[model samples]
Target: MNHMLLTVRQDANLTDNLVGVNAMEVLINALIKSGAQRSSLRAKAFGGARMVDGLSDIGEANAQFTLDFLESEGITCDGHSFGGTNARNIRFWPATGRVLQRMSTDRLIEPKTIVQAPPEGNDLELF
Candidate 1:
C-alpha cells in the first residue's frame, strides 16, 4: 500500500522544459527507484491554484495534466482539488490513500488554476 503525491504547481520552467510533458514520468520513475511496485502505485495530486490575475492559468493546466497522466498510466486517482480561484491545502496519507483538502482565498491575495488534459474518469472530491 504505497502512495505518491504530485503537487503540480505552475513553474516558470514548464514553459521551456520537458516538464510540460515529462513531469509525470519523473514522478513515476522516482517511486520505482524508491522500491515501490508499479502495480501498487497510486497518485493523489494537488496544487495548481489560479494564484494570480491577468496571467495564464497554469495551475489548472498542471493539475488537470497530472490527473490525465495518472489515468493514462491506469493509476487510481483517489482524490484531488484543482483549478480554483482559491489556493488549497492538501493532506494525503500515502500509506492509506486518504486525502483532505481545504481551499481558501480570503487569507491570500493571489489566484491561479491549471491544462488541457482529456479525462478518462473522475472520482476526486473537491473541498
Candidate 2:
C-alpha cells in the first residue's frame, strides 16, 4: 500500500491555509472519496521550518498540530522531520514510503525579482 505525505504547517502570520490545522481532515476526506479504507491509511510528514528571522516559531506549532491531528484520527505517523531553522527540500517515494530530506542554507527572506506585466492590449504607443 502506498503512503501519503502531508506537509502541513502554521503560517507565520497564523493564517488558516491549506497546510494548517485542517490538513489531516482534508486528506482523510480525499482518501475516502478515492476508495481508500481508513484502516489501511497512514501518514508521513515533513517540513515546518523556522526559516524566517525575528519571528515567532510557527514551525514548532505546525509540527505539534500535525502530531496531534494524526493522533486524533488514529493514523500512525510512521516518520517525520519537523521544526528547525533551515529550509528543507523533500523527495518522497509513495511506493515504498521513503523520504529524502535535504536542508538548505537559504533564508526565507531572500531577495526576489519582481516582474510587472503591462496591462492587456495596452502597448506603449508613443506618438
Candidate 3:
C-alpha cells in the first residue's frame, strides 16, 4: 500500500526561497495531481525547535511560515506542535489518520531540586 508522509525543514531562504511559496505550491500541486482536492486539504505541522544554542533561532520562523502558507491556501491545520527547546519523536499512521508525539527537552533538569524562598530578605543569592 502506498502512503504519504511529510517532513519539512527549512533553515533559511537560500536558493531563491525554497521555504516559501514556491515549495508550498509544488507540494500542493502534487497532492492535487494525486487526486486530493484542494478544498479538502489538511495538515499537521511538527518538528520546529531551537535544536542548538548561541545561534539564530529559525525554527519558530519555519513553523510560522508553514502555518501561514497553509492558511493562505485555505488549508486546515488541525494539529501542530512547534517552537520549543525540546526534541520530539513523532509517529503517524496515515491509514488510520492517527498521530503520536513524544517531546524531551535537551536541558538536564533534576526534579528533586526544589526552590525555596530565601530568608525573606532583599539580598538575593545566585545558584
Candidate 4:
C-alpha cells in the first residue's frame, strides 16, 4: 500500500496562503479530492503541543478543530496524540490513518506521554 505523509506547521501563512485556505479545511478537502471515502478513510491527528505555559490553549484549539472537522465530515479518526507542554515529532501514514507521536522535552516543560490508541475496525465509526 502506498502512503502519503503531510505536515502542518503552526504558521498561518504556511497553511492559509500556501494551501489557499486553513490547514484543517485544506486537509479535509484534500482527503476527499484524493479519493478517500468517508467510511474507508481514517484520520490520525498529531501536534498541537503547547510548549509554552500561557499558550496552551492554542494546542487545545488546534486539536479540537481537527476533531470537529473530522467528525463533521464523517471521517473516522483512527488515532490521535495532542495537547502538551512539549512539542512532538509525529509520523502519519495517510492511507491507514496510522500515527506515531514522539514528545520532545528538551527545554521547556514536563515530560510528555502518548495520548491515543489506534482504531480497531471499520465499525469504530466517527459519525
TM-score of every candidate relative to the true structure: 0.68, 0.73, 0.68, 0.59
Minimal lDDT window, size 10, model 4: 5-14
* lDDT, candidate 2, 13-87, per-residue tens: 346534455555777788889887888778898878877667787877778777877887788899998987787
Ranking by TM-score: 2, 1, 3, 4
In model 4, the Cα lDDT at residue 72 comes to: 76
Looking at model 3, the pairs that clash are: none
How would you encode candidate 4's per-residue C-alpha lDDT over 32-112 as one tens digit per residue?
687765456566667666675543355565566667666776667666777666777876655565667778866765555
Give the true-structure RMSD of model 3.
Answer: 11.7
lDDT, candidate 4, equals 0.59
Top model number, lDDT: 2
Candidate 1 wrong stretches, greater than 4 Å: 11-17, 107-127
Give stretches of model 4 more than 4 Å off. 1-25, 109-127
**Model 2 poorest 10 in a row by lDDT:** 12-21
Residues 1-127, candidate 3: write the lDDT tens digits.
Answer: 2233344463745543454678778877897798877777777778677766655767777777778777877778777888677778889986655788888856723336479866887789879
Best by TM-score: 2
Q: For candidate 1, what is the total of clashing residue pairs? A: 16
At residue 107, what lDDT does model 2 achieve? Answer: 64
- Per-model C-alpha lDDT, please? 0.73, 0.76, 0.69, 0.59
